[model samples]
Structures are given as structure tokens and as C-alpha cells.
Target: MSDDKPVHTPLEIKLKLSLERQPLPNISYYQRLVGKLIYLTITKPDIAYSVSIASQFMHSPTMEHFNLVKKILRYLKGSVGHGIIMKKNESTQIIGYCDVDWAGNYIDHKSTTGYCTFVGGNLVTWKSKKQAVVARSSAEAEY
Candidate 1:
């Protein structure tokens, strides 16, 4: 993945992932990779959605799933400097940004949401997660 062309985004928006697919023979490797990615999310929240997408098939990952994870690896390799960086001497301002994806999941058609909290112009925390309930519209999802 070090030599692979880096993508500007963590996940391919057009790619629709589903559960009804051929399973990969090696599950341990996929599990380990996803685990590491999950840990990496602590700093690299940009990959949170990508890691969550790959984690859905942890028990029975397919080649497609593995490829999705590989894309994340390539992203990490190319953008080695991207991630959270706390700094001092900035304004003690608290700001947050949140976004929602309307029914982005192909299988469950559930919306996904992500949020980031910044303190003093530095990213302090962030998260991305699928909604628990089905949203009728993007407005409802955001609400």
C-alpha cells in the first residue's frame, strides 16, 4: 500500500457494500487489520467511517472488505502528516462540526453521522457512527 496512489478521501462513496458476498478464507488477518485501524481512529478520525465500514465484515470479511481496508492503508501511507495536532496559545474557543449521510448503508439503509469538536482551533475529539434508527429524510437524520 506504500506505493499505491493515495485517495483524497477515506472511503469510496460510490462503492456499495453488502453482507451477501463470498467470504475471505483468512479472517484473522482482517480482524487484526481492523483492530489496528480502530485504534488508529483515536487520532486519525478521518478514517473513522472507513474503519467502521471495514469492521462490519470482521467475522467474515470478503476480498472486497479487505480491499476497502487496504485503501485506508494507502491513504495513511500517502498522507503521513494528516491527523489531530494539539497546540498551545490559541483562543480558548469551543467549536464543533457534525455531518450526516442520509441512508448511506446499502444493507440496512441507515444514515451515518460524524462529528468533530475543536478547542482553541485544535481538534480535540471526533467520532463517526451509523444511526440506530432509520431516518425518513436527511433532515430527520440530522435532527
Candidate 2:
């Protein structure tokens, strides 16, 4: 994959992934790759959501999951220098923004909540994770 062309996106838009698909023989490899990607997310929040999705299939990855992982790697290769940079500021206030997708996961019908916190004009933390319980309505999901 050294010569593989870089991709602009880590995961395809509106991608529907499932666990019912055929499992890959080399599950260990997939797990290792996902573990590394998870570590990378510490500095590269942009890839956090895609990496989280890939991590879900660590126990039973399919070719589709592997392809998505490769796409993430390609994206990393292209944007190797991309990362959050903190600049010194006099202000110390922290601001946060959050949102949720209504039933974003087609497989489980669970919404995904995403939030980011900024301190002194620099992004300090962010996360995107699936909700534990299914929301009955979009308002509930957003809440």
C-alpha cells in the first residue's frame, strides 16, 4: 500500500456497514491496525469517527472494513502534516459544542453524539460515539 494513491476522505459518506458480512481470516492484523489508528486519534481528531467505526469490527472484520482502514491510511499519508496546533492566548474560557445524528447507525438504529471543546481558541478535546440506548425521537436523540 506504499504506492497507493491518497484518498481525500477516511470513510465514504452514508456508508452502511454491518457485522453479518464475511469475516477476514487475518483478524489480528485488522486489530493491530485499528489499535494503531486509535492511538493516532489522540493527535488527529479528524480521523476519530472513522477509526471508531473501524474499531467496532476488530473482532470480525471484513474486506469492506479493511478497505475503509486503507482509505484512512491513505488520507493520513496525504495529510501527514495535518494536526491541531495550540496557540497561546490571554483568554482562559472554555467553550463546547455538541450535536447528535438521529439514528445514524443503520445496523443498530442508534444515534451518534459528537462534541468538541475549545479552550482559548484552540481545540482541546473532541469525541464521537454511538449512544448506548436507542432514542425514540430526533429530539430525544439530540438531547
Best by lDDT: 2
Candidate 2 local lDDT, 88-130, one digit each (tens): 9899999999998899888889999999999989998898989
TM-score of each: 0.91, 0.95
> What's the lDDT for residue 101 in model 2?
85
Q: What's the CA error at residue 3 for candidate 2, in Å?
A: 0.6
**lDDT tens string, model 1, 31-112?**
9989999999888887888899999888888888988998889888877898777789659999999999898888888898
Question: Residue 60 in model 2: shift from native, Å?
Answer: 1.0
| Superposition-based RMSD of candidate 1 using all C-alpha atoms, in angstroms | 1.5
Kindly give the stretch of ten consecutive residues in candidate 2 with the minimal lDDT sum.
Answer: 17-26
- Residue 63 in model 2: shift from native, Å? 0.6
Weakest ten-residue segment in model 1 by summed lDDT: 1-10
